[model samples]
Target: MNKLKRRSDMLSKRNVIIPLIALASLMCCFQLARDLVDVEKNLDYCVTQAGKTLAQINRDSVFPRDIEKDGKRWNFVRKEEWTSGFWPGILWYLYEYTGDAKWKIQADRFTGYLNPLTRRPAVDHDLGFQVFCSFGNGYRLSHDPGYKKAILRSADTLATLFNPKVGTILSWPFMIKKEKWPHNTIADNMMNLELLFWASKNGGSKSLYDIAVKHAETTMKNHFRADYSAYHVVLYDAASGKKIRGITYQGYSDESMWARGQAWTIYGYTVTYRETRDSRFLDFAQKLADVYIKRLPADLIPFWDFDDPEHGLKDASAAAITASALIELSTFVPDRTKAAQYFKLAGQMISELSSRHYQSRDSNSAFLLHTTGNKPANSGLDCSITYADYYYLESLIRLKRLAVNQTIYDYLR
Candidate 1:
């Protein structure tokens, strides 16, 4: 009789536990559905604001770069400027989101301004920034033959800066004389490698792929310290490829972690891993990302420098860039627990950035504010930068795609 009673009680408990589990799962699904709806709404808002910024900048017939805080005016740049591609890249993203013809028209026009860059000599490492962000996205969306040709040409030109002995591309030819860096490679150069990687597979030389891998390997070796916090600049011996010193040109100090520079490594190594599927890059990227996440403030946004004593200034651009990279990195990591953590962190960052605290809203036409371009030089501090807007939209798109079980690489061929 006691056994029968115990069996009955056990069955009852199982019944109750199963229902509770089902309810919890149902609630999780409901929350995810709501979050995805919010993502769509936020993307819609972005489309509206980006359209307004486009109209305002179109009047000046130039690409939007950053805002002048003193006058609260937009700063426009010509096509040759390093930042010129982000404006068109934003337009391309908007068109991809809305499938609207107007954005495509403007994106095409703005991207065409960069065609001249294909014929010019490789001025610096920024050719990837100037050509790939604009023409690369254009090719992805439209598959335009002209865009492909330009990307191939620009990739070849960018290769000219690579010295085989240094195992990395020279970041600033101009800075060599001005700063006495025999061969300098910055963390920012990691971003330019994507153009070379894409070009290598799409009608360009295979040497481009090798160059990119070599640069990434070299940067991974020399740019990061024991804690995986990256230095902004690492000077190398041009002839022997020896790392002379790692210093900071833009951070608060030589040893402090620059927010954007570290963000670039997170994003850059994520891309390198994706392109090569190398476990070394993947593991390194996770380490870099983990340190950045562990050190971020409660809101998931970072100060201009992680080691800054004051922590007075926040950088929305760095937050946006990190969020975008984290979302993509989450997809690549093999461990489910780590992946969930990364995705959750990225979602938190997106939530914070979407709030009025970061969004420009009525204050400016730019998507987000409080980006620090160069705090050391006292330039573009607390400003709305074009790259901030570009990457914020990108993160939104990536988040939305992930909600639908789509990968961030869905758009890429």
Candidate 2:
């Protein structure tokens, strides 16, 4: 009887404290609500803009590159580019949101364009990014048998890149000129592991699942610092499974934290915890989340590299990816206080991206605004990119799902 009375007292205290906390945050909460209205309006504009963009591309009778250039020019990229899947993935999200049959038709057509690539398996480690994002979303929404076969076959090809000795997939078989990184694995590879996990349970080889788990474990052991910031690359000795060194190809320096790479780690481990339900993965994700949150500016958008002295540019793609991951992360966090914090941070990121960061004036551009691609390489800096738009649409859909008390993973089911 005493224990029951104490529990009741604790519940009562929580009830009072929760409302007081909400009251304290009333202004911020009101601003967030206002931002959500803008999100809805922007999404409606995105659907129409995307439809027009697709129509123009189809009418041109040419394949499209991953980005929409200024003055309404679009480039065509080959199937081998790491960014190829993002275009179809955007169509899938548009279809998901608007429930418009035209978007569905466009998604099917665009997804079909990549179907032939699955038949000619290449050494590229980005098959997950190029195949899974398109076909995985397709199968989830449409249940098309053709999309399922494509994803499973793509998984088979991706498995061939795994080096059993190194316990991870080789990110690049070749290196830049004058550089020799033979057994290099990159943080971006973590995003690809989810496809392997999905393939294992959905009809592909079960070994794919094991390969993904091992890769993740190996990355966890080597890819992060004490602060939980991720290195862009970790070189390993293929013959001995020994560590070579951690380095950066796209970050400002070898020691600098690449913003997008950190986003990949956050999203990857959240998916890992979803697939395996491992407490270690969840705990690691939380730690990484805190590290990322601490590094953000007042707007919650991150620069291209966290350690760069000049804050001249921001990567909206990184912000979008991180926000989407946090939505899922909030659902898994066991601590109510931390869960609320994660959710609030996610809202802040989406709102910031939607408000001043997005390209509000450009109705002709199919891409989102303010994305920095490879600032270290001095290429595509502060330009709109396909993956940026893809993840932004994905994040918006995730927030919409949360509003309805649904999880993003439910779409996969």
Best by TM-score: 1
Least accurate 10 contiguous residues by lDDT in model 2: 1-10
Model 2: how large is the Cα RMSD against the reference?
7.9
Residue 56 of model 2 has an lDDT of: 64
Residue runs of model 2 more than 4 Å from their true location after superposition: 1-37, 58-71, 176-178, 411-413
lDDT, candidate 1, 366-410, per-residue tens = 888888999999999989999988999998887665454344654
What digit string (tens of lDDT, one per residue) describes model 2 on residues 246-333?
9998998998889999999999999998788788999999998899999899989999899999988888889989988987777677
* lDDT (C-alpha) at residue 361 in model 1: 81
Residue 288's lDDT in candidate 1: 98
lDDT for model 1, on a 0 to 1 scale?
0.84
Model 2 C-alpha lDDT versus the unseen true structure: 0.78
